[model samples]
Target: MERYVDGFVIPVLNEQLDAYREMASEAGKLWIKHGALEYFEGVGDDMEPDMDGMPMVTFPQLADTESDETVVFSFIVFESRDHRDEVNAKVMEDPTMDSDNYEEEMPFDPERMAYGGFRSIVSYE
Candidate 1:
């Protein structure tokens, strides 16, 4: 079975990493409660890219991370595109997602965050 995913990458200030984790934890719980199969939030603690091979754009470069900032990569998985849509609809309506609250408490800059949906091409295991 194919799975769908909503992914995001955001650059956060080093000082705000802990606050970001708190927010991501709350969001993760909400997503799980709304039927997301899995929710992942990863902070870049060691983004040093090895130059042993072909170079590629890394999370730091992609998000233009600064020395005082760390990058966060996150995702929510669903059973399919329709399932993703359904879950998202519920998430939007949940009072826990109050826009004003988020705007005030967000740990990162919304305008600089990257977001997208993807369909899994292959899965092993």
Candidate 2:
């Protein structure tokens, strides 16, 4: 069966990477508790790759990151689009998400974060 996934790309200050990881770890737990199939948060260790002269925009370029910042790529998977919606709804309603420091604690600028939902077109495993 095909799956649904919510993906995100964010530019985080190098010094705030730890804080971002902490927040994302907690969020991942909440997502899993709310029925998400999988959660992953990866920091960009390699923002650019050699493409044999092919033109392509790198993660840093897409995120418009600076020398003091790096990119974070994350994704949460669900059984299907409907399942994703259900899980996200539950996650939003989760009391743990209502922290008073919600906005202040976020390590990256929300306006610069890119988010999207995708339907899997192929699965090999």
Q: Best lDDT goes to which candidate?
A: 2
Pairs that collide in candidate 1 are: none
Give the TM-scores of the predictions, in the order they appear: 0.92, 0.95
Candidate achieving the largest TM-score: 2
Task: Give per-residue CA lDDT, model 2, range 78-122, as digits (tens).
Answer: 999999999999988888878764766588898999999999998
Give per-residue CA lDDT, model 1, range 1-125, as digits (tens).
99999999999999998899999999899989999999999998768778789778988999998889989999999999999999999999999887776655577898999999999999765
- Model 1 quality (TM-score): 0.92
lDDT (C-alpha) at residue 19 in model 2: 94
**True lDDT of residue 65, candidate 2:** 95
Backbone clashes (count) for model 2: 0
Worst 10 residues of 1 by lDDT: 98-107
* Candidate 2 lDDT (Cα, 0 to 1): 0.93
Model 1 off-target regions past 4 Å?
A: 100-103
Shift in Å, residue 32, candidate 2 = 0.4
